[model samples]
Target: KRSCTHRYCFAVCIKQDQRSRHARGTVPTSKERGVREEQIVKKIFATMVGSSSSWSTALVKISPYTFASIGIAISIGVSVLGAAWGIYITGSSLIGAAIKAPRITSKNLISVIFCEAVAIYGVIVAIILQTKLESVPSSRIYDPESLRAGYAIFASGIIVGFANLVCGLCVGIIGSSCALSDAQNSSLFVKILVIEIFGSALGLFGVIVGIIMSAQATWPSKG
Candidate 1:
């Protein structure tokens, strides 16, 4: 009976040890499960917030094509305005002076025509600029880099238009300053013609150079 009691005590101790081990293991597993659930909730919340912000931003984004087209249209309009004003001021002044002078002299005709040519030149240049700008690849139209270039071209167009306007004004003033006696003298006519021709030529050359420089300098943005 004493041996049986000893065996029973040993078996009871072994069963208690197994139960203790199971309980200890379960505590760590439950803690790990809780940590995993918290991480999942945090990730879901962050994703939801990020998605909402992106949707809001997308609504404000401008299309590149639309921006470029609007810029081109404005540029062309400015050119037209400058050109029309230049023609009216210079051409009308010349006609009025010729009528008052009552002279159908070659010098008068040449002077009138030279002053009038600025408007025609401006139109031609504007057309060329429009053509060049329009020919730019459609694929590149909306690119940030290309739009930057377009802006530069627009700026150049503005400068050229202004220069032409100034040139026209100067020619008109020269015409108005002329006297009937000055027109009769061939030597004086030659001298004045030289100066006028050189000035108008320089203005035309500058416009071309400005366009070329702007086109070359303007680079596409790599957004």
Candidate 2:
């Protein structure tokens, strides 16, 4: 009889232990596990959705004025650098050639003028961009219109800057060649000058395009 009673008590203790484990969630049932997995999936989905929206909002919050300023700086800075580079290369060649043929001095000045014009193109584009920049209220800084305007202005500046930079280098190299050729044979001066004129026109093309691109970029007003 005592053995039977002991066996029954042991069974009751095992059952209690099992019940406690289930109640404490140490052993989750299939249904409970599925519910947990669903909750985890929902949380992950919510997190992914939140992160995606935050990325877009962060992009939109970027200051348009900052990009515009950088654009303007690049346009002027790169154009000036190109012009200076061209002038340096051409001037050295021009001075050397002039020493051989003094008569070509005045005529070869055209090349220098063309190089200088590249810098002017940058300045013109920069001015246009500057004018397009307006003081906007804090509320409009993240507006879609403002973002569009900023991007347009930045693109315009980049287009003008790079075009002028290339144009300047082309003119300078060609100008140097022209000076040397003129010293050797005066007839080559006009032919080479024609090519230089075409090279200079490349910068003009950039200016026109930049102007057109920035034309529609207007900052939104508070009103």
Candidate 3:
């Protein structure tokens, strides 16, 4: 009887230790582990989504002046790039053609002038954009009217810049062709010159639209 009693007590002690371990979570079930993993995943997902939203909000809250400045730079820089490209291509062709037909040199100068006009268009748009900029304080950077005006000016700059860029390229390509054709037959000069004029008008159209778009872009004064 003493031996039997000892065996029974040992078995009970083992069962109690197992129960305690289970309660203390030292021995978690498959379901419990799965639940914990799911909770962790949920928390990570929530954190990622929150961070993305916060980043977007931060971008939206950036100062309008920053956008305006970028717009102005793009207008001038891109226009200059286009003009330079046009001048390079046209000037090269003009020089080659002038070597054979010296008289074409004076007439072909009109092509270079057209390319220069593209840069002028950019300068005009940049000046207009600069005038629209106001010295807004950091505290008032989120003003709605200011933001609207800034966006308008920025869009205007983009329109004029891109339009003038295309115009310059168009004129340059045609001018090159014109120079080559005129060297072959002088009659082609006037005909090609008309097409060049039309190409230049594209830049004028952009300028008109941009100016109109920015006409109503006045920021509210500090009250």
Which candidate gets the maximum TM-score versus the true structure? 3
Across residues 1-223, which tens digit of lDDT does each residue of candidate 3 receive? 9667655655665567568778988976778756755655565456546667788788679777877888788788888888888898899999998998998999988999999999999999899888988776666777888888888888888888898899889989989998999999999999999999998888899889988877867877766
Candidate 2 per-residue lDDT over residues 1-223, each given as its tens digit: 9667655655665566568778988986778756765655565556546667788788677799988898899899989988998998899999998887999889999899999999999998999899999888987897889998998899899989999999999999999999999999999889999999999999999989989998979888879
- For model 3, the superposed segments whose C-alpha errors exceed 4 Å read 1-52
Q: Estimate each model's TM-score.
A: 0.52, 0.74, 0.76
User: What local distance difference test score does each model get?
Assistant: 0.55, 0.87, 0.84
> Model 1 over residues 147-212: C-alpha lDDT tens digits?
565555555666666666666666655554443435355356556666667656645764776567
Report the lDDT of model 1 for residue 75: 39
Better of 2 and 3 by lDDT: 2
- Backbone clash pairs for candidate 1 read 145-220, 145-221, 146-220
Task: Give the lDDT ranking, best first.
Answer: 2, 3, 1
Error of 2 at 199 (Å): 0.6
